[model samples]
Target: MSLRTSLTAFPRQALSRPNWRQTVKTSLVNYGDQRCGMAATAHPVTQDSTGSKGPTAMVFLNMGGPSTTQEVGDFLSRLFADGDLIPLGRLQSYLGPLISRRRTPKIEKQYADIGGGSPIRKWSEYQCAEMCKILDKISPESAPHKPYVAFRYANPLTEQMYTQLLDDGFGRGKGGRAVAFTQYPQYSCSTTGSSLNELWKWRNRLEGKRANGGKEGEGAIQWSVIDRWPTHESLVEAFARNIEEQLATYPEERRNDVVLLFSAHSLPMSVINRGDPYAAEVAATVHAVMQRLNFTNPYRLCWQSQVGPSAWLGAQTSDTVQNYVKKGHADLLLIPIAFTSDHIETLYELDKEVIHEANSPGVKRVESLNGNPIFIKGLADIAAAHMRSGQTCSRQMTLRCQGCTSERCLEQKKFFAGPELSSLVR
Candidate 1:
């Protein structure tokens, strides 16, 4: 149950042999017979006459970062090359490498500032490990909820995770299912959508190839996506609690005077023109958190992580801080509403650059929701919501954003609600 515990190394034969489920089983066995240690201890849940538990694979997706200095360029290249993140039309092939290389040095410096690389993957792994324990406690009757990590643009890529999960017998039978959980608190075409698209592509290409060659429903995973949860009550509570803790640093009387600045990563205007919902969803998250706190102080939502010279969602975080300082607000508490964990954006961009620019005695950055017990409980709540209702993509809570026109998201919703998923309804 400890987040510090490392997943036991997979045996050499697990990778060497063609049998992937056996490989997973071999690896799971190394964690001892206890059901609380590793993610592999969970089995899938299925409905059948035999009453055997159908194994379910839970995959966590995120925008992965470079683990080392040497990998920075590769990470940028993969990120820039993805048409979803940076839409280049036909020029993508020609411009991707150019942009990636041109930005590598400056980006590498930021990574170095944050201790040589981003710890996003490390944090995500720990989150997944801890989440499995929570699932076991809350839903003991369900299939063991095994957790898997899939990154969009780096190591432990989506393809790798999907294949490994499929090999482990998830989505391979009538009762089998796979859950695609987006690590992003809010959804965007560029983040969760892109990751799911990549995942589906792998699913399509490998369908039936593992257990039966090209047979319908043979080796196919019944996928459900947890695309967005900006307004989830538990998540809002976590953010509110974190901000309250940060506020406690100030004198009790002065706390009311502190300006709350909610900062989120910015996306290009081009993406907005194409109807991405990132901006609106981020606003919703900030609003929800503020509501949870019943905050009376003045607050402003701003954007960060604007690369290149292109215009992005605004007002910029740094600029917003300067504006607030100009307005004579001596106290400023910067809350990262769009991010769930600390990484380059929070560690360097906000912590180093924005703080230096603010140059105010009252300026402070709140810690991200990494390994916070309340936040972990919130995530467990999200997983439990999906498990009990057999619902995905948050349709029951909120409608698709008015600005979102993503065909990929539309397709995912249609598929999730179709006859194939009817069996999952509880």
Candidate 2:
């Protein structure tokens, strides 16, 4: 049977809840306020008199997935409309919507298979809130860290998150510090970069002008970024720990022989050709994890999730798995190297699709770093270090991609990195 026929044959679990959109919308409305109340009560923001930069807003940025099947349409529409991501040019306005509409059903089915929606929102919120709790204890100066999630394509979008930040008195002349901590471990122009650009755009619109018509950034939330941390020691340790735990499940004798396959979402070669740093950064992460494991098992980095017919960075993960299994190397452990938590990619793509197709008992995936204490602690360490450093962004963030020509990229870098480092961009 064709792919479409197979998809249709699968159960439509999501259809059981026709009001999923409303349910999610109502939940989102209460999510921030509820979390804020809990955070304020638990780690009350002390005054600056105590040398505390209290009530620091910690905004987690990511390319969010739809939380429900109903949201898939809008999610894909926004995703396709993003010039930084897809770049359909002048016809984008017309074609983006058209393509998204056509693709929504298939994508919706994927989400349905993964329990009717993406668990990204749930995991992101929990991770950020827990990380903030840790930050309050470790980074007292930036204590009472308020967690916020800003997804590029889903609810609690950048605009909504920023508005909530202002409402909570972080900006709009309050002059509070906020960090745009990208959840993407490795930076990608299409992922973190696009999120930052969208963030910059919203900052300009919402906090651009003061009530007295003062300068653009007068008393706005001072913004900084934790752009990339692919090889951070804590992150490496967390990944290695997960890998070790997964390896423990194998028989003691076969453990060392297992081929570790590190898989990441693929980028179109067009983006790679533009000198995007994502591919390199992902490799760095994989190598770091392997080094932490003392190279006990052989590993190879492969890419997955290529859309359309365009060339993408690969050894595609699925193809690699099939070839390995054919070569009598069925002892394989798949590690999702780039993403922090579970999503459709992990739930449906890796679990339901790839592993199911492979039909090999030896081909298994490592658990996602979702709600892992070590991983959460790593996030806190990264944030605490960034807060202590007083740097607006990483030095690497100041440098544009070798072939980048986007004016938005230039301005966004300038806005966050400030004039001092902005000079380094060309």
- Provide TM-scores for the models: 0.82, 0.88
Q: Tens digit of lDDT per residue, candidate 1, span 1-426?
A: 221221122233432324543533444455334445645554433443131333556788999899888899999999989887777779999989999999899989989888998988877876776677776666665557677899998888888887777666655554366678899988887888788778866776666344355555653577777888898776786688678878989999999889999998888898887667788888899888888788767899988888767678789999989888889988999999988888888999898999888899899998787765556666777776777776655553134445665666555545555564434322
Q: Pick out the ten consecutive residues of candidate 2 with the lowest summed lDDT.
A: 1-10
- For residues 1-426, write the lDDT of model 2, one tens digit per residue: 222222232233431223433533555456666756743453323334243676688999998899999999999999999977877779989989999999999999999888899989988997898788778777888777889999999998999998888877776677888899999999999999999999998988888753336557678788899999999876786688678878998999999999999999998888999999999999999998988899999999999998777788999999999999999997899999998989988999899988989889999998887766556767887898888888999999998999999898998998889767888876
True-structure RMSD, every candidate: 9.5, 10.0
Rate residue 178 of model 1 by lDDT: 68
lDDT of 1 at 180: 84
The 10 consecutive residues of candidate 1 with the worst lDDT sum are 1-10
Q: State the TM-score for model 2.
A: 0.88
**TM-score of model 1 (CA atoms):** 0.82
The top-ranked prediction according to TM-score is 2
